[model samples]
Target: MTVVGKFLPLLGWVLAGVLMAEPASCESWVDLNVGSELQRPNEQTVVDQTALVRLNTRYSAPVGITLNAHYGLAHRVRLVDEPGTGIAAAQSTGADLRLWDLPTELWRSDGDTWVIEQNLDTLHGVFYWGAQEFTVGRQPISLGVSRQFSPLDVVVPQRIGAQERSYRPGVDAVRWRNPLGLTGELDVGWVFGQDNLLFARATQQWGTVSAEFTALTLNQAQWIVGLSTQTFAGDWGLWQESAWLHDDVLSGARITLGADRSVWSDVYVVAEYHYNDVGDAENMTSDFFQKGLVTLGKQHYVALNASATPSPLVNLNLGLLHNIQDADTLLLGNVGRSLGNNTQVDATIEVPLAKQDSGTEFAQIPLRLAVLWSTVF
Candidate 1:
């Protein structure tokens, strides 16, 4: 069937929601963020800045609709991107996966030392029909159970060094959810961006543990079978997510096992171990940029993270990533404090423990310092 034929049914439900929505029952809000980053490599330094806005509205009903839109403008000076990789390229796929991207960059400039661009990042809605739910337009569809790395997150994969955690870049797509009893649900989705993607997940809650099974195909070029589970034991929580990827681009098994616990009222810690057999350990390839393989040129990795809330308004987080094959490590840190009830500021930094010419994962990545301020109104 043609694309429109598939969406005709979803549009019917959207029309139903439009006729049933009451204006007085609508809820709306806005959020803004401004950030500046300093990226220093062994060779040069680059400055990146951005301002982002999110406007959200929701109408309450059995068949509800939510409209969330994001607008962002980015300015970057001094281009020192690694070969075949850049932040703009990683996020270009945001929007709908089964159709097209919503990030319609209104205008952009590219130069040897500077770049400027703006776009609409997110625009999507949700509606329900009896026990079934449908989401359409542009939205973030994140899937994973791992804390540090998730091999099964093929929908909207997160960047390893990305500082923004508040938003999962939106993509264009349509999704459906059907409840299976009280503890289980079946999810199915389609995204068409650079390529067509179709995926599904069936989840079930067994006692205190939740487990999910997943399958996805990307433009007939790739196929993946995945599994994930989450459970807690006493004060310690544990989870695992794994996937077996098969494709002409790359094929192999990837997995991560993780555990976390609160050591005290103010501190929490987590440790995770990841391994993959398909990644090329000898070369710093753009596999992540081109093929969405986040193994990062290594077969084994260890991640440790901790968070502390010393006061009501102050918070700190630290993360350590070790690439086993390359013997290089990277440390990520963030400190934040509230300026008021509706405003906050955060400072983040990344330090690599290896020389930039060492051909290691962290070695090639530059040291980064960023400051971000956000407010809600």
Candidate 2:
């Protein structure tokens, strides 16, 4: 049996115990999401279409405990208009799969063109007491100050140009957080398994500025230290994060600086710059996908994002990413509207700009259009 199958019965027993033992109030909710995407490559003769459905549930008890879980189903179809235009692509684009690393294939056929996958995105428990909190099981952990690019967020880092509706994958860990004072706190966590991934962070706030320092140990041999800070300058917000890794194999520093400002009441713009000393500028595509040393593979990058809400129920977003060394660019846009109190619809497009050669980074990505619908009950 699969890991999820073995754990389901145990989870059911625990939920029953919680419901029977607690005399306090209990709350539950469910969410349903459906998404479709189409891709057209520049020189390819085939078009690809993908469909996905996901269900998520959450339960909270008055005893200061909560449970959450998610399940997903997806299908992909390829149309071959020309025989020579069909090419296989990579299964995943990013490399942040440290936690909950399970095999995703439930069933596959037709030369792997048709596939079925099941994922358990989140399955965690939380307990609270006074100013202290404890959490265990599979959960998401993110650390950093920058919004677009975070150099300090090494664990389960965000992927660039991925679908916005997809949730961050959870990792199995035990974590603790405690309040130091009115404006200070401390967080500590240890990810399970053989890698010995342990981390601690301290944060403090003063007036309109906040700062954090973190230390991480990997496999009991390598260490990484990070610092991040955020502050307001007049009407604009500014932040920076930096991290240095000490390891025998690869040792370097990564830094990110970002700023954002509101243009009007409903519009805002953001810009960010990132630098990674461990990245390669000459062979970006191979370095990023094969070696997994850096997220972008380029030593220097610049990113810009803007969002506007013309009405209460509609929003528009635009994003641009440029590789300074390779001169490749990625452009993204999205439009979303609220259908009612419980439903929303969104449309998005992604286009990559690069040379025709396969060696270029962005050129390998096909032009993509996606639509998503979600409802909550």
Candidate 3:
């Protein structure tokens, strides 16, 4: 079926539900964003422009049921000053670049200069009763302890440096959660697809500490177990997450440890270290584009991020990521300013540091600058 054919049916369903809902109980909003990026690598320069629109609506029925629907439209264009640069590199590398910035379900390429896409980010129904809730349809399910990187976020993991981090891609699934006690809960979910995912998680809290344990099965063949925890000591926050996968081909573990603290009431600093026992240091750069157990192919990684807000209207962020095995580093910096009540603007820059080896991970990335403008209505 065509993309429009698939979208029209979903749109009709949502509209029908909205019509049946109470008039004053439905809420809706539209968000628009425009972004431009410039990248330079070697002697080549590339420019990309993108526009995105999102329509979100929620309805609360009188009988404790809630419906949420979110739709998105996007258009992107890329221009390269020289051949064999930027996206060309990505294409030659055989990386699934579309997964990084575009939706996969409903999209089409328009000639060689433009790409248009549409997607349903969320279409879910929830039934709430006391401390128990059941959700069905497409929705996001996140499980982890770390904020920046999570080894245990196996279900619908967010892409690194994603533009829309607020919402991860939703999965077709059924999930149930119930409170175990005053400070505990149990969650179970099943995601349907070719490689189906089934998992159960238990969470507990004590004082200023919280912990979670999960067991998951993939395709009824591989098993994965995860543990994560977070605790507060004085003014510092500490977290750790670990996952172990049992498979014939890819059997190993990944772990991450992190700490964060606030300074001067307006500045926050965070540091994290990640270790992937299954990662390959020799093939780190080449294998990075391949689908694998580890998100990053290098064995060890360290990252530091700091954010400061000098005033209510402006925020500054700086971050650094280092690949210990390959000795490659990436520097990130961004500034955000609130334009008004419902608008904002941001500027960001990323610089990769590595030897002049085309195979190296950081060397393949260009120095990039991005400007973004967004507004909500």
Candidate 4:
């Protein structure tokens, strides 16, 4: 048997206990999406400095498929496939099977629940790890209390291979969670044999206000610090976040503030401003602070987004942005339609109404359209 094959059952058993102990109320759902973007030289979505800049936007779309199937054999044993392998040039399938809720009594006394959640993006199976209960394996790591700058987003699928979108494989590592009255986590990972990627986070609640802090060490480049606070006032929710990054050469900060109002059922409007200190002329750019650039370190912006779900199978989003530094403007519109229980389709278009003086001419006329189909069983 292959090495991976030999370890399957043991890993399955470990994952089962973790899932039953902390299972989130969920249902098995499979998602397949195909999308494309249009723009000019270096006018695509913002990413890290370590990533290559695409000179031209073309007919690129996510062609991959994923699945997560769970069978509750008993109250304590569930069999499942994390993301059925369908990702290699040689192997058309990327499937991994796991067992959930084995020997589920580990945390019955704690009044906490466990759920086994897996994604196609991270191929590794994660069980609660160590004394901290850290979910380990290939997983999504969201750092900080704010949404603007996420320094721990290494496993994003679109960043690794062209066939996948918003999916990424987890690095080999151990993660821990501390739930002793407060909630927090610490994670350590090795990417490309470099073991410097470390993450720590904590969140607390006090009456109507909450706060969170997140910090990280770059795999080989920098250190990041972030903090955020949020409060509810009447029908509006207000929040703010600030982050700083430092390394051997570069140094910068980002501040973001926003408010959201839910005036109706299942509908909301949000206004946010993100200001990035993207200048470090004396110091080289650090790898950890790459996604902050909406225009490659050229502009600051305030954006408004409105979202509504009219039904269980339909969703819509409308966005407008104004670049505070360069006076550029942007408009975006998107909609999604669910085709079945496991399949759906969506489309997005972004238009730049004004251009910055950075001299990237193609950024003036960025447009895109795409269609996708996916399934699981």
Q: After superposition, how far is residue 327 of candidate 4 from its true place, in Å?
A: 2.0
Among the numbered candidates, top TM-score falls to 1
C-alpha positional error of residue 296 in candidate 4 after TM-score superposition, expressed in Å: 5.4
- Candidate 4 lDDT over 1-377, as tens digits, reads 64445776897786565555552433333233233333332343311111111111111112211112322211111121123211112121111112111342222212122222222234343333234443433444444443332322332312111122333333444456565464433334432222335666677778888777777655535667778789978998988887777777666777788888975888888887777675332322445324221122443667787889999898887777666666666667778788887666766666666444444322354443434343443
The best-first sequence of candidates by TM-score reads 1, 2, 3, 4
Model 3 weakest lDDT span, ten residues long:
90-99
Better of 2 and 3 by lDDT: 3
Report the error of model 1 at residue 313, Å.
0.4
User: What are the runs in model 3 whose C-alpha is more than 4 Å off?
Assistant: 1-24, 41-43, 79-81, 84-111, 161-164, 281-293, 355-358
Stretches of candidate 1 off by over 4 Å are 5-17, 20-24, 59-63, 74-98, 101-116, 248-250, 281-289, 293-295
Global Cα lDDT for candidate 3: 0.75
- Per-residue alpha-carbon lDDT of model 3 for 1-377, expressed as tens digits? 54434665786686467657645388999999999989887746778888999999998877667889888987767764456532321121222212112343244344344566777768878878888999877788788877766777766566554334577767667799999899999999987643467889999998888999989876666677999999988899999999986765567788999999999999999999998786765543332223222466666889899899999999999988888877888888999999998999999998888744556666666788999999999
All candidates: TM-score:
0.85, 0.85, 0.84, 0.60
Pick out the ten consecutive residues of candidate 4 with the lowest summed lDDT: 48-57
lDDT at residue 339 of model 4 (Cα atoms): 84
Report per-prediction Cα RMSD to one decimal: 4.1, 4.0, 5.0, 15.0
Q: Give residue 297's error in model 3 in angstroms.
A: 1.0
Q: After TM-score superposition, what is the CA distance of residue 10 in candidate 3 from its true location, in Å?
A: 15
